[model samples]
Target: MKGRGFIFAFLPLLLTTCIDPFDIGDVVNGQPRLVVDGLLTNQPQAHEVRISYSSPTLNTFDREVVSGADVFIEDENGSQVSLIEDTEREGVYLTPSNFAGTVGVTYTLRVRTAENVSYRSLPEMMRPVAEIDSIYAELDSRQSLSSLGTLLNNWGMQFYVSTGTGTPESNFYQWKWEETYQFTAPLAREDQIIQPICYQSGRQFNQLLIGSSQDFSQDRIGRQPITFVSKNTYKLQQRYSLLVKQLSLSERAFNFWSDVEVQRDTDGSLFDPPPSQIIGNMVRDDDPEDIVLGYFQVSAVTEQRFFITRAEVPASPGGPIGGFSSCVESSEPPADGNNGESSGGPDDGPPDFCYDCTLIQGTTTERPSFW
Candidate 1:
C-alpha cells in the first residue's frame, strides 16, 4: 500500500512533465530579440510594419515596442515612401493611405531604430495570386482531453478553400483568416434592459498557413484545409462568419514561411530536430552576424468571406447550447439587476455577464455590417 501511494503521488508530476516537454525558461532566458513584421500587398491601402522586441522570455506574449524608428519601403525603380509612426499605436509604422504594391515590382523594407541600429531586407518581387474558387466547411469531430483527463470527442466544422489552378509562377501561396460569431443570453427579458445578443470577433494568428502546388500532378489547389471551428464553444452556437485572405508568395518568401512553420510546430522531444531560430531576409547594416527576427513579405492579395448558420450543423444531443454553463441565475435575486446592483429586486439577476453581454471580452452589442 505504501509503495502504491507513492507511485500515485508522483503520477501527476510525471504526466505534467510529459505534457510540457520543452523547458522554455532554459531556452528563452529573458533575452530580448528584435522582431520586425512588415507587409506590402497589391491592395491599395495603408500598409504597416511592426517593430518591437520579443517579450522577455518569461512573458513571450507581451512585446516591448520599438518606437521612433525611421521606416520606409522602396522599389527597385528608386521610388520610395517614408512610413510614419502611428501615434495611436506604438511600434507600428504606416504608409500613405493610397500606397499599394504593383505585381512584378521588387520591394525592400528598411528600418533604423531609436538606438540607431539599421536593418534591411533583400528585395523580393510581388507575385500575383489567383482568385479563390470557393470556401466551404465540413462537419467533423475532434478529440480533446477533458478536465478529468479523459479523451472526449467534440463536434466542429473544418474549413477548406479551393484556389485557382496553379502555374509554375503562381504555385506558392499563404492564407490568413478571422472569425466573427453571434451569441445570445440563455434567458431573455421582455423589456430590453440590455442587449441580449452580442457578437464576438477573433483571428487565427501565429499559426502559419501556406501551400505549394509544385509537388502535385494537377498544378491547382483544391480543398486546401485552412482552419477549423469546434462546437465545444459558443462560436458555432449561432451564426458564424469567416474572412479568408489569400496571398501569392515568392519562392524565397515561401521557403522562409516553411522554416517558421517547422519551428512553430516543433516539440522539444528526443525524436524532434533541435530547435533553432529561423532567420528571415532582414540583415543588420553594420553587423552581418547579428540576427534579426521576423520577415518582410510583398505579395498580391485576394480575399473572400463565408458564413455558417447554426441550422447547417447537426443538432446536439443535449439540445441547443446555453450561453455558458457558468452563466446561471442565483437562487436569490439581487436588489437592482441593472448594472449589477445587488439591492434585492425582482429584476435582479445573478452572474453579471448574463445581464449584460458587453462584459465579455471581444463582444459588442452593435451588429456587424456583414451580418
Candidate 2:
C-alpha cells in the first residue's frame, strides 16, 4: 500500500468533486487539508499518530509534514495520554512506552496543529484478538520464465500463518510484519580477516493485509498466505527471520482498510475500478466542509515470529542465486593458498557491527531477545 502516494494521487480527484469552479478562491486561499494515520492496541507499547498535509495543488503530490502539532489520546476514564513529536520521524507523535489502553474502553484522538486548527477522531473502542496459533515459512516454488524466455527457475518462499478461534464480535483482522536476515560482506578490509555474518532487519512499509471471518463458517483461520521472499535475494542469502503482528480491527476500521487493500490489488489491472477517494476517520473540526484523507484506527494486537534458516529454503540449481560463491577473491588475487577473500572492516569492530550496530538495510547486529 503506497499510503502517502495514494493520498497524493486521489486527493486531486477528491478536490475536483468537492470544489466548485465558481469558488476557486476557496481552493487557493483555504488552509491546507490534513492527513492522519494512527492505530492503537491493547499491547503496552509506544503508539504513534502521523500527521501530514495534502497539497493537491502542487505539480507533484507530496505529503507535507505538519510539525509542531499538539497530539494526544484520551480514554473513557478521562485520563489523557500526551504524545510527543518524534523528531527523527517527521509528523510522528509517540506515546509513552507505559501507555496501554484496555479492551472495551473507548479512546479519542485529539490534535491541535501549530496554527491553532484542531482535529479529533470519532471514539474508537479497543477490542481483543485471538493469538496466532502458529506462523511458518513454506518453501513454495516461485518460478517464472528467465530473461531469455527459455527456462523457468525456482524463486522464493511464501509465508503462511494461522490463528485460533476469534471472538464472534471481533472477527476483523489485519497484519503487519518485520523481516530480518543475516548477510556477509562480499569484500572485506585491507586486514584480510574474514568478517562474521551480520544480521539486518526491516519492517514491511506498505503491503496491507486485512481479513475477516464474516464469510467463513469456522471461527478460526488457517494456512493463509502472508508474504513472499525471493530465494537467494539479499534477505535469503543466509539465515532469515520474520515477526508478524496481528491486530483486530473494528468494523469501521476494517471497511477503511478493506477499501485500501482492494484498490491496491486492482491497481493498473483492466478490471480495476475507476479512481476514487477513500474518506477516512479524520475530518476538519474548523470547517466541516473540508475534505480530509486518511484514518485514525484503534485495534488490539497479538504478535508472533518464526525463523527460516538458509538451509531450510532449498538451494536452487544455481546455489544461492547471485555471487557469494567465493567471497574470498579480494580486490586482487588471494595469495594462492587462500582462495577465499580475507575481509574485515578497515577498522576493528565485531563482525556484526563493523560500522554501525543499528542500521543494515533494516538488519541489526544486536540479536533479537527472542533469537
Candidate 3:
C-alpha cells in the first residue's frame, strides 16, 4: 500500500502541529464582560440599584465593587428575594428594607461574581402608570439660582400626569421624580447637600440639572416642564404604584475620568492664584468663572421630545415712555452686576479691567464674566 498512504498523510500533519497550552492566547485573551442598568419609575418610594463596570485599562484595575456580589430576586410564584450591599455607597445593590414591588409581580435578577462571573437578568414585568396631577408653585422670574445671585429667590416644582393608554406600540414609558426634604435641624457641619434638583427623562424628554449654580455660565433655577395628559383627566391614587420591567442588555462597561491640568495666569496678575487640583473621579475647575468640578455621577438614555402648551405672554414692543413705566420697567443689570468690579477694588492700578480681560489660554486661567 504506498507505505500505508504515507502513514495516513504523515499522521494528520503530526496532529495539526501539536500545540495546546489551553490553546495559548485563545485568540488574544480578554473575555469578562457584564453591565446591567436598572430603572423603575413612578418616583415616590423608588428603591435603589446602581451597578457599573468596564475596564481593560485606563490605568487598569477596573471597577467591580458588587460588595460581595451574588444578588437575587424572583417572584411570580417562585418567591425569592436577596439584595444587599450599599454601605453608604460601594457598588449599590439594595432592595429589601421592606420590599416594595407589587403591581402584578414579575421580577428576576441573579448576579454572582467574585471572579466566578455569572450574570443574568430577564424577567421584569409590572405596569400600572398614572398618578400625580398636583404639585405646583410659581414665582419663576425666568428661573435663577446664581447667574450672579439674587433673582426671584429660586424655586421649582411641577409634575403632572393623568394619562393612560398603551400597548399601541409595545408600550415603554418611564418617569421618576422624588423629592423628600425634611430638615428643620441637623446640619451645620458635614457639607455637600444637593438633592433632587431636577431629573426628567420620561422616555426622552431629557433634562438633568442637579446641584445648580457653581456657575457654568449661570441660568440656574427650579426649572420645570413635563406634561402629557389624556386618560380622561385624572384618578389613580390609592398611593399609586406602577411597575413594568423587561429590559436588560448588559455588557458595555468603560467608565473613564482623568483629564484635568489647569493653571492659568496669562496675565491678569494673580489676585490670589492657587488652583490646580486634579485628583480624578472627574474634576474640572480651572475657574473661568468656575466650571464643572469633582463629584461624579452621570447617567444618560434619551429619545427626546416633551411638550406642554399655554404660557405664551408676548406683546409689548411699543415705543418709549421714559421715567420707568412700560409696566414697571426693569430688564437688565443684576447677575452680580460685575461682581465687586471683578473682585479687586481698592483702586487697583493697570486694571482698566481688560488685560485682554484676564487672559486664560492653556491651563484654564479664569476669565470670562462675558470675556
Candidate 4:
C-alpha cells in the first residue's frame, strides 16, 4: 500500500471547521496539528501505528514526523505492550510479531511525544469479520468526460465480493485490496535469452471503501462491488491477482470513514456540503482542547485472493489496450544481435526498456510464490 498521504488531506477538513475567518493565510502559517493513524487486527503480525503532524495545505514542506515518541497499546484486561519506533521510518511504531488483537477485547492507543504532550484514544473493541464466500469479476463500462468535453465510454472489469453475515453486533465492514499482475515485454524471445516476463503490484489508495449490512434488510452483504479496474490500463493486460482484505468496523468507525468518504468525493461544487470537523477519538492530556487528526482502528480482518487471465475479459470495443505500444523495434537488429541496443549507437539508442523488459518500472522477472 502507498504511504497514508490521506493524513495530510484530513488537515484541510479540520482547519476549515476549527479555525476562524477561514483564511488561507492563517492555515498557511498555523501550527502543525498532531495526527495518529493506527490499526490492530486479529491477524498475528507486527501491527503499526503512524504518528505525524499535518503539514500546511499550502506549504511546500513534507508532512511533519513526530519522532522519538513513546507509543503503546493497552487492553481492557490491564495488559499493555510498548511499540518500538522504526529507526528508518521515524514516527512509525510497530508491535511485537506475535501481538494480535483478540475479538471482544477493548484496546486503547496511547502516545507520548518527544515534547511530553500525551494523547490517548477511546477504547475500541476488536469485532469479528465475516469470511468472503466468493470473489468474481465481470465486464463493465463507465462513461467519463474526455479532454474535449465529450462523453467517452471506458470499458473495464468490476470486481465483487460475496460474504456471509457477520456477528449481529459487528455488521459494518471495510475492504482493502492489493493487486499483482504479470506481463511480458514485447520484444523478448527465448532463443535470444531475454527475460520477457515481469510483475507489477500495488494497492488502491486515497479512496475509502466501506459497507454496512445494516443498510440491507438481510443483514448480510452479497456481491458488494469493492473496486473496479478500467480496461484502458495495463493491469488487465495479462494474468492478474487481487488479494482483498475485509475488516470489521464498529458503528462509530463506520460513520467516521463514511464522513471521510463524503469529503473525499466532493468535487468542490457549490451544492456540496461544507467539510465539517472530524473529531477523532484521541484527546490530548496536556491540552484538552487540541484537535487530533486521525483514527486508531481495531478490527478483525479476513482475506481472499482472486485471479484472472487476459482471456477471461472480453476484448475492448475500442481495440487492444495495455500493449507495449512504445516498444518499437528498429528495422535492423544490433550489429552482433547481442547488445540489445540500437545499431545507431549504444549512447544514441532508444530507451533501455525497448530492448529489455526488466527495465520497465514496477516489474520484476522473479515469479511470486503465490503465482
Which candidate leads the pack in TM-score? 4
Q: List the global CA lDDT of all models.
A: 0.70, 0.64, 0.28, 0.71
lDDT tens readout by residue for model 1, 46-120: 888877776554454555788999999989998999999998988889999999999999999999998898999
CA RMSD (A), model 4: 7.3
Candidate 2 lDDT, 1-371, residue by residue in tens: 31211121111222111001000111223445677777777777888787777555643244478899999999988889999999798788988987887988999999999999888888899877888999988766666787888767556788978884755543777777787777665545577565656676666543556677766556577776777887645567667888998888787878776665555445576777864556777777888766666677788888997888777877754456332322322232122121222245424332322222232334346666767
Poorly placed runs, candidate 2 (over 4 Å): 1-32, 58-61, 88-90, 143-145, 149-151, 166-170, 183-195, 265-273, 316-365
Superposed model 4: Cα runs more than 4 Å off: 1-31, 56-62, 145-149, 166-170, 188-191, 266-273, 316-318, 328-355
Give the clashing residue pairs of candidate 4, or none: none
As for TM-score, the candidate ahead, 3 or 4, is 4
- TM-scores vs. true structure, each candidate: 0.78, 0.74, 0.24, 0.81
> Comparing candidate 3 with candidate 4, which one achieves the higher lDDT?
4
Give lDDT tens digits, candidate 3, residues 1-371: 11000000101000000010000001112432233334432232324544444232332244343456766666678887676777787766766665666664566655565655555444555544322223332222234455666654222223332222222321222232322111111112235352211111112112211121122232222222332211111111001112112111111111111111112212335664543322212211232221111211112222221222222111122111111111122221112111111223335422212222111111123322222
Best by lDDT: 4
Ranking of candidates on TM-score, top first:
4, 1, 2, 3
Backbone clashes in candidate 1 total: 4
Q: What is candidate 4's lDDT per residue for 220-325, written digit by digit as tens? A: 6777786778776667778989999988888788877666655655788899986444666788987888877777889999999999998998885755654444
